[model samples]
Target: MPTLTKPKEHNRERPVVFMENVSKIYPNGKTAVQNVSLEIEEGEFISFVGPSGCGKSTIFNMISGIIEHSVGKLEILGTTPTLARQQSTDVSFVFQEPTLLPWRSVLDNVMLPLEFRNVTKQEKLEKAHHVLKMVGLSEYTKALPRELSGGMKMRVSIARALVSKPKLLLMDEPFGALDEITRQNLQSELLRIWETEKMTVLFITHNVFEAVYLSTKIAVMTPSPGKVESVVEVPLPFPRNEDFRTSHQFSDIAAKVSQDLKF
Candidate 1:
């Protein structure tokens, strides 16, 4: 049996993401999220899971400054979300689809972000190549998106996200589109990247098992008019493998997260 490790206490000096009584109401008078609050510390991997229409993606967009919250306070790295986005390379987002440009090579795709910056062409090339290597896609730098498999394309997406060296990475069901085998493989790969990069990750997914497998904490949300019902801790040690996934502790935590989603 794999030993279950207890989660260590975090020093709550300044959270990477802080939300209090945050709510999002669209112009049509529909409430997407209601009074959702969460505090995520540095280097923690947090996953949000809930039923469909639970406002999981809504919360993500709000945090990323794609949209504004209708009420309450929201801050990223002690600054307003908009300011955090404009003044610093503190955040990045990965969506459900890989969203790669079919015409562009892997290297060019990853270099897109840096091209908009003040860096020289050589500097952009170096940064893009570095991140491609980090994501294990260095050898595929010249391949177009159509030439890669689903998993490989997602790797390119991840590399693009990391090219900016952001402090926070937000993913919206990034692996939901892959097959089981590929999904499991990428889940492990993502963990490896997270550990190596040491960035705060906020991942939204519908898979309770994936959430338990990858996250330090799982935030379960209620149905439409989404509110965080509970945040369950996964007190498992790092470098978790297939053995840990099949362990009793893994099943217990997954079941608990499922129960929370049901309520």
Candidate 2:
């Protein structure tokens, strides 16, 4: 493991992810993101929330190196996302939909990441099985996507993201399509995984309660030419269970984030 370097006294903990005055503009002169800057502490689960066409997805794409920012710096684990990609740095992404292949079994879908960097078939299967166990889906390894329920399929997606043992996981509304009960269940599952694995997360969501319930801090983004309006820290203790949802502290933080979103 590489020796971790601390930042300054006030910002001493080196950020796992950093965005410095980043901006994105399309050829048609539409500015998607505007001068956004934020630092995400290592192992922190930070969420981005905003309305549609507010550049939330664009910001995610920039962080994932799916597209380059028009200006400023963006870093993941001290390296640009593009550089990290080149080095095969540990980072995984889960999209809104499960997006699993219908023909492939759950184990095969989870093992797909290994195929990208030349991992052997045997090694891929072993790693896939390990992560499947982590997500409580070991029993369904041979099941196809069509065979799983919505929540179960999302669990498979989560397992797939973990198969690579990434240090950072980027999720763009991974549970948006699920029913409320399932979304809440997956939210708790995600927190449990993060607590155990200590992976840094940059999640994008429209749901305020989900943002507060799952994040260490919520980054509120404004609509159009989207930029972070506030970073509200959720002081609630970790290993948070369903009981935390009914707590005053969680409600207060969630309310604050909700207000910020409407601004």
- Candidate closest to the true structure, highest TM-score: 1
**Model 2 over residues 1-263: C-alpha lDDT tens digits?**
11122356674655777888899999999999999888777788888889998999998888888899999988888888898766874888899898999999999898888887778888988898988988889899999999899999999999999988888899999999899998898888888889989899989998898988898888888889998887888777788888898988888998888888777
What's the TM-score of every candidate structure? 0.95, 0.93
The C-alpha RMSD in Å for every predicted model, in order, reads 4.0, 3.7
lDDT minimum window of 10 residues, candidate 2: 1-10
Candidate 1 Cα outliers beyond 4 Å, as residue runs? 1-12
Model 1's alpha-carbon lDDT is 0.90
Give a tens-digit lDDT track for model 1, residues 164-187.
Answer: 999999999999989999999999
- Evaluate candidate 2 by giving its C-alpha RMSD to the native, one decimal: 3.7
TM for candidate 2 is 0.93
